[model samples]
Target: MRINRLIYHEGKVTNPYSVAPTSHFFGSTSQSDPLFWFVYACGPLPHTRGYLLFGSTLLSGWPVSTVHRKEASRFVPSSVRFFSFHYLSSASSFLHPLKMEFKKPATVLNLANIRQALVRMEDTVVFSFIERSQFYESPSVYAPNKYKIPNFSGSFLDWLLLQNEKTHSLVRRYESPDETPFFPDQLEESFLPSLNYPPVLADYADEVNVNDEIRTVYIEKIVPQIAAKRGDQDENIGSTACADVDCLQALSRRVHFGKFVAEAKFQNEMAHYTNLIRNKDIKGIEEAITDSAVEAKILERLIAKGHAYGTDPTLRYSQNPQSKVQPEAIAKIYKEVVIPLTKKVEVEYLLRRLGDDDEAEAQDPQRKTQLMNRLLSNSLW
Candidate 1:
């Protein structure tokens, strides 16, 4: 296999016949002319390590180094295969579209990826909470107001949520299987084209939305984690309402992250989950996801994030003179509300594992009882 010699001059590639005019190489990143790209394939001596000679001068930027077989394939584009025989000969097996298909690397939904997302989310949650902490408690935001607007009622938060529905409706953030808005019924239909959220986990959508449970627990249990410190001041209705909306949205995202965790766990231990679901064993499901070791690490990470974000040296002499957010409180929330609720969601979702088509088996009380008894007898629990 042979390709026309590529004459490189003044950072542009030209053919020997001068039939094709000089053109910049696609994605040529170097600033200067005579840029050197370590020749992987596409030259007289393909296997030997050498620089692509640009008019008898060895280009400065390209380093002469041994190229791995795997990396050599990446240097040439499929579109230019006929033009470069060196790449064509090596990658000829890939020429037949029917024989083999090229695809982007798969994004495996696993614990490591989920944990990385959770780590990034910690920053979002902590920062949102910090912003919200500046305002004092205003219970009025959750209550019905006597004054009513054209299409809005309830407190200030209501109007704000309505405004979001009107403006961001086009973006369709709610359509994302990952996102669960606090005001689901109130959300306007999205006008924009829908985009898939982690199409790889499409099956997990039925289990992902634990927003209602998260909102309930957050308002009842997790609010004290931050509100207790910030709520001591006199109420500022506007600020408080804004803060409440921000806090709830951020908190919801953090808690619902359990879906990712659950998906990862299920993928890792499919057999274990299948057995538990078959036996209708809730306790087994809980135990499978519960790892005291991992939970401890998560709690410590959240606490550190809180301290890092909460304490500002410039505010040391302020009248408050205290961290608006407490590390211990953050740690406690994860230990008690966040993790427990997440595990609960996983168990609940697993309980309904049999889809609508399996209604008969899923709904049969007698079948469930027998399975439970059989599992108990076997000491599988």
Candidate 2:
């Protein structure tokens, strides 16, 4: 049988023999003769018969088929069946659609870039801390049931953070390798599209979650130290909680980014790290990598950053202008906690990196070679 001529008007398909309306083309009407409405995007010429395989089941309008008028009705049934069979055969083939894959940039997380991130984070941390400090360490904020969040305990900060992460975790926040959530269990499944982040970091990047440690340090040490002089009344609980959470997230980002630094360092000096790691020399590893001068400089920078951010520049010739924010305390936090924790992460990652390299070599020689090549090419080492 041949489909001689076909015409499309609105939702109707008319060939030389018969007119097929939308009602007849759809539902139970077409069930008995389902192949009757094969609609191809391209005009059906005799040569490109293969194109007809992609035809839709829906009734579509074409100007008209080219076949002769007398033989149209006789050819329609066989032509439709052939089209259906072609479609099924093409669909079952092993050939797949081309998928786009994004590789993470290898040079994205060197020491310079990581330090720049730290510098940027300083502004965020200071601004957030300043905003939270407006509430002046209100005791009621830490009181239970202050904020009614489901399946939560502890302070208003905790509840607020819990709910915020629950929503944001489904978006871009959780997927970012740099962010570590305070409440992992509270995070909802990500409803957002995948960003296809590059896995330039070591495998140990997934193993660490410093959120709990950060939260504890902030609450027990950083807050009291900063707010030691804050003697104010309980006011503006909501703003305070929000600011607190923002500061917490900023801090988390800063601390967790240690993974990137560690990755960069290990990639650069794999041999040096391998020697220390093989010998199980944690102290030697620390000594080899740690620059006391650099650490001292970082502490000084923090102190300077605190003073610059905390003090009002507008006040001219002010006598003994007491700053609410403590610069020395910030310096101390970095000097003691933040710097040490980052180095600790470096050591931890190096320890695991040796094993990961060995495993990769054992399992996939090509992959190990590629990784070795990447490490060798990195001039930053």
In terms of TM-score, how similar is model 1 to the real structure?
0.60
In the range 92-211, model 2's lDDT, one tens digit per residue, is 121111111123243454465566667778888777776666666656666777667677677787888888998898786877777778877667877667887756766567677767
The candidate scoring highest on lDDT is 2
The lDDT values for all models are: 0.54, 0.60
Candidate 1 per-residue lDDT over residues 1-381, each given as its tens digit: 222223222222232222112232222223343434434434222433321321211323322222223333345444443355554333321211111011210222435545666677778777776776666554555556734657665656667766765556568777654566666666676666666443434264544567666656765676655664533344466676667667667766666656656655654565677678888888888888888987888888888788767878787667764666787887787788777876776676666655663345445556645643443332211
> Top model by TM-score, which number?
2
Against the correct fold, how does model 2 do in TM-score?
Answer: 0.64
Evaluated at residue 55, the lDDT of candidate 2 is 31
- In model 1, state the lDDT of residue 200: 34
